[model samples]
Target: MNAYQESLKIKRDNYSALESAELRGEQRGQKQGEQRGIEIGAELERAKAEREKREMAVKLKTKGMHIEEIAELTKLPIEEIQALV
Candidate 1:
């Protein structure tokens, strides 16, 4: 083949390689973003659950529940229950 034709083929191959690389990079970025979103969601859920547990502990404490019983019933640490008192 002529030099002109060979050069064109090389350019086409390079362009194809660049396109493939760009597509792979986008997919990797999307996956990473999805994973980050999942992590944030889990963290939010954990925070909400912790808040609810603390509220319940406070209510139980107001009702004159024993610290040890509150700890056992709520599955919270004894220290945490005592702190609420």
Candidate 2:
């Protein structure tokens, strides 16, 4: 091939390679973001369950139940009920 033709071919090949690399990078970033979102959602669910359990303990305490009895009824640790009181 002539020098001019060879130069044009090289330029085309370089452009194609750059385009492929950019597409692969974007896909990798998207997958990482999705994984992060799933993790955050799981954390929120765990926090909500803990809050509800604590609220139930407080309600029982307000009803004049002894801390030890409350712990037995709620199946929670006596220390946890005492802390709520």
Candidate 3:
């Protein structure tokens, strides 16, 4: 190939390499974002469930239920349920 043509080919090669690297970087970023979103959603769900359990424990406590029974039914620590009194 002529010098001019050879120079053009090298330029095109460099551009293609850059484009491929950019695409790979974007894909990695998107995957990381998705994983983080999933983790946040799971954490929120766990928090919600814990809140519900505590509410139930409070209700049972008001109903004159025994502390040990409340702990077993709500899957809460005895000390935690006792603190609700």
Candidate 4:
């Protein structure tokens, strides 16, 4: 083949490879972003649940419920329940 045609072929191959790499990188980035979003959502849910449990434990304590029973019902540590104001 002529030198000019060979050069054009090489350029076309390089461009195709670059495009493929970019597409792969973008797909991986999107997957990572989605996974991070799910992780954040789960953390928020766990934090909300923890807050609810603390609130319930306080209410039970105010009602003069026994500490051990409160710990069991709230699934909070005995030390945490005792530390509640």
Best by lDDT: 4
Candidate 2, residue 63: the lDDT equals 89
Q: What are the runs in model 4 whose C-alpha is more than 4 Å off?
A: none
lDDT (10s digit) by residue, model 3, range 1-85: 6999999999999999999999999999999999999999999999999999999999999999999999999999999999985
Model 2 misplaced regions, further than 4 Å:
65-75
Report the C-alpha lDDT of model 4 over 23-65, residue by residue, as the tens digit. Answer: 9999999999999999999999999999999999999999999
- Local distance difference test, per candidate? 0.91, 0.88, 0.97, 0.97
Error of 1 at 76 (Å): 1.1
* lDDT digits (tens) for residues 2-62 of candidate 2: 9999999999999999999999999999999999999999999988887887788899899
Considering only N, C-alpha and C atoms within 3 Å, which residue pairs clash in candidate 2? none
Please give each candidate's TM-score: 0.86, 0.78, 0.92, 0.86
Candidate 1 lDDT, 1-85, residue by residue in tens: 6999999999999999999999999999999999999999999999999889888999999999888888887888988878884
Q: Could you tell which candidate, 1 or 4, scores higher by lDDT?
A: 4
Q: Total clashes, candidate 3?
A: 0
